[model samples]
Target: MCSPEMSRSSDVDVRRTETRHEATHVKARRPGKGGACGHMALCHWALVAAMLCGPARTQRPPGIPGRTAENDVPLQTAAWLAEGRITAIHLPKERPRRLYFTLPKKTSAFSVTVVPCDVPVEWSLMVRTAEDEPPKQQRTYKKSMPEVWWGNSRKNIKVYSNVGNAVDTYRGPAYAPASIYVVKLQSREHSTKVSVYLQEGAGLPKVFPELPPDPQVRVVGVGMSSVTLRWPSSPSVPKVHQSNTSLQYCVLVNLKHNYRGLCAALEALRRDKKIEEVKRQGATLWPTPKAWKQQLGPHRKDVVFPAPVPDGPPELPCVCQGVENTCTVSELQPDTLYYLDVFLLDSSSGSSAAYTGTSARTHQEARPTGTALRDSKPRWVALAPHGGRLLSFRPRGWPPRALLTMQVCSPHQVRVTASGQTQVLAAEIVAEEPVQIWLQGSPSYLIYLENESPATVAEEAIVKIQASSAYHRQAPVLPPLRTVKSYSKLKTCNSVTVGWHGTEERNLYCVYHQQLDSQGGPTGLEQCLGPESRSDTERAVCKYFQDLNPQEAVSTATIGGLEPGTAYLFDVYMVRRFGIAIKYHSKIVRTKKDC
Candidate 1:
């Protein structure tokens, strides 16, 4: 007689096969073959029949092969299998098996793949939730047999079969975090074996480990629309412990409406004397913990809880990662107080560390209405060759000190004098350009510009002057160069053509080239060429052009002395007034292998 476990396994197979045969009215039979069980005696068949006809069988249709009640045999339960275990089960003819397990609270999904042994077998799989509702059924093989082949030419040679395999995935409604799930496996005819592989959770930890100690965090800057935060680098840990680990950050913003509501609710909860009654009424209004740090156990000390925002709403933070030690949050309300909490996440182990909270208030928007610096447009001044133009005006409601700005609108050798002073405040004798001068002690001033060029007096030129409060002083603005192009039209093995437009003044233009590695990082063969050179190699590689006309906007330079069959990156920039460098464009070029 078969043992209780063996009997139950056979019974499960009988019920499943009977159900399938009843629906299709077809029976699957295995031919007598020479293999593992080919030499079994008649007693073996008798034992299988007895197991199928035992009390476990329930009344069913006359033509069906197995008892219906056999499907109810209690399943073996086990804890979640660890990451690398290959669980297997042996199923005899007509028997089915069931397994129950629980998923971790952080587990989002689970998957299982069933690989059958070398035999002809039909299998059916069903997954049900805790509620016992069978939402779907997955079948691996239907009316099919494993592929068979003979290993040798001799008839006595061994035969091989390719067992069927199928993968079933459970997600969302089929399985939930921290919920119970059931998986049932049943085989139709022939006694066979199967190996089950399961992957639980979405490959992430449900709970993170504690953070290391003494983390420092601070607010670096605040503005009307944004706040900048900074923190020290995470402490270094052993590679074995931190491999595959990454960090992510989150920031929560409490809207104005929610903030006010939470503050009022907390105050009311504090004043209520009957704690039980308040609790019974659902004290959901209580604030959440100040930060995730409070959730860590007492053993961790490096992290500190952020103080709750005073009279402000509970925090709803926002998060970002990848900005080493510094992160900026924008799109904030003007003149508002904000509480920020920053945290660190270890992705591999699902561990997190948080910094102490910091708070800052944004400044009110600046209003420049009614100020002398507002709406001041550039005024045009004409100068004849070797002649000068003078203008005097008092700026009303001006600051004690103001910024006087002047730009030559046309090509001219211009000299500027202020307040009748003999000293020349600014001159652009070499090239027409913009100039800024600081004026103090008086709001009224005389300004004069003369065409000091040796050209004849018949030639005419134009200049524009703009004066404003020093608070309005802004960096010089220049139009960006566009349509940057790089090519090797000459097909030279060691040269490339770099061209661009939009040069507004006699500013110094430079082309920098560097050999780059496969990852685009510099390989230390960096070289720069321009109108000015600070090194011997730069002087040898660069060509100088003097007194370039602004109207001659288009410029191109040919760079040589490059190695054959090499990749190089090039960028161009201009040094504007006051020595401000502005990058215009960049490109990559690869040289031909041979000339």
Candidate 2:
């Protein structure tokens, strides 16, 4: 039943076997031709050779001569083999192939290409030294590639690929014998192609330039919640580079609402209050003070200053340091709610802007309205000497005075006692007549009195004599206690200049100065500075701004050495000549640059 093709394949296999047997037999019969074990070893070799040649892929056997299984294989299977020419051999049993190749001195990263022959099969690749040890592994691709596959290229290896459909190809990194490195590539595909080369190096990147700086402006006249703003010309602006820009300043209060409008409205209110006058020039009816008069609302002659208005009166200068000058407001009642606003007139803007801040209420004290006094009965009188005593008074009449006499109906012998002494004097009633008598005592004095009533009778009365009572002449009342008002200036690197002003400078000329924090608020830090505290040569009482705090901003400061312009706080006091000393007030001052 065997076909012709199957029969031919068997015949060829049989003849090849018979030829191997006859050759072995001939070698065994010959004396010197056989191997050490004679024809028996030769027959074993012949049978192995026969089997390898019988329609199967041949693999190497052990102990072979002139052929080895370790060195014979396609480039795809032995990718680690170096770059130059290669020699290969095959053995029947132990190993299928052996490979050898020369390597170049230098190389770069490389890759491999592969083309499969016959059946597609999965394979792994590895490399190592011929002598010993496990092989080093390279890259491994998990998925299958096409018959003609490409690999990662490297600098040194130009190109490598499968040579023919009959043999499998391998590819990998560049190899160098100097380093003895190995590369490997394997795939399940039938074929693949890979090229290796070196490209240019990566360079550094560029950077972005920086932006311009922020503009700056000057700040001045800072107050509780706002600051006066002023700025120099913008350098970036054309032609107007050095010219000052006219700008309206705004106050940001708590980052909300525009306070500038409130300020402006207040200013407008002041402007409406400004009074202007027109006077005759020479013999003409022209305005004399041309610059003084402001235009009126309409068809009205130029309004005159001190002009009366519906608000009851004209503007009157509240003259300070002068008397008889009256300031009046018609609508003002006994106790009305009102506020005063101060203003500064700007000639250029013709605007009367309220002074940054100056408003206060009018005085609340009642004015005098002269009236008559009512009569009252005199109280009981004391007959004490008030002697050498300064605690009694004897009023003679309505407007009590020194020399006055009075008559009363009483006992002729009346007794008076004071300071442990008693005296009896005759009392009499005088009719419309005056008499003067000098009181006799340690502190002697005189008095005269007369009765205005007619037809009075003579009677005994106690003529009590005593000195004027010391009622109004009491211990001087002290003013409320206040913090000392002192100011300091930096004089030198080691000292500070102190200054103070007070009302009692005449009687109690001494001033106590102490350093305080910048806010003019107390620092609880103080030092004395007055005649008693100063050494010789310094005046007993220094000027308001000359002394220094020992532990001041400087050692011995003068005004000039302080920060060109800076604020400082100080405490000052006044020592009275006789009464208890007082700390007058505390103050703050900004040191001027030139001071």
Per-model lDDT: 0.47, 0.28
Tens digit per residue, CA lDDT, model 1, 378-435 = 4556778888876654454545444556655455567776652223344334224446
lDDT of 2: 0.28
Query: Per-candidate TM vs. native?
Result: 0.22, 0.14
Native-vs-model 1 lDDT?
0.47
Q: Residues 457-556, candidate 2: write the lDDT tens digits.
A: 2422323222332222223222233333323433434334554333322434343233334454532112212234443433323333222322221111
Question: By lDDT, who's the top model here?
Answer: 1
Question: For this target, which candidate reaches the highest TM-score against the unseen true structure?
Answer: 1
